[model samples]
Target: MESNILVIYTGGTIGMIQDPATEALTPFNFDALYKHIPILQNFNCRIDSYCFDPLIDSSNMNPSFWIKLAKV
Candidate 1:
């Protein structure tokens, strides 16, 4: 049987990379996540991802965010 999994990335060090030009941290190319994490392809299932539009920092987490996350 095939399975479906949803991956939600809420902005963090895990989703960041160092910018070679500026030597600063920035959001990594989410589209290339599967390419970077090839282990995902090992699963016989469909994978999907969801990212926050504005991308919230962990320090700014709030109840509304939890609600929105729950909805997703």
Candidate 2:
């Protein structure tokens, strides 16, 4: 059976990459993420994400956000 997998990244370090030019860590572009990690394309499932417009700090997470995710 095929399953839809939702990978939620709350702007944590796990979802960032080091920009060699600027020596800074930036959010991975979910749209182009597969290009960077080609192995993901081999998966048999559909992968999707819901990201913040501007990454938010984990400490600032609010209930409204959870509610929004639940609706998705």
Candidate 3:
């Protein structure tokens, strides 16, 4: 059977990348996810991602965030 994995990106250091031009860290655009993480292509199962709008910081997570996460 095929497996399905949902990668929930809640915005944190894990999704930050350094801008080569300015040397400043910025949020990575999930649209180019494969380019940044080629290893994902090796996975046999189907992998999908869901990024929270406005990207919540880990330090700022609250009950509302948990509710939203649970609904997903």
The candidate that wins on TM-score is: 3
Best by lDDT: 3
User: Residue 57 in candidate 2 has what lDDT?
Assistant: 72
State the C-alpha lDDT per candidate. Answer: 0.86, 0.81, 0.87
TM-scores, all candidates, are 0.78, 0.78, 0.83
Candidates 2 and 3 compared by lDDT, better number: 3
Tell me the tens digit of each residue's lDDT in model 3 across 3-67: 88888889999988999999998888877777888898887887777888989999999998999
Candidate 2 residues 6-62, lDDT tens each?
A: 877777788898898998998988877688888987888788887876677778789
User: How much is 72 displaced in model 2, in angstroms?
Assistant: 2.8
Q: Which ten residues in a row have the lowest lDDT in candidate 2?
A: 49-58
Error of 1 at 14 (Å): 1.7
- In angstroms, give how far residue 22 of model 1 lies from its true place: 3.8
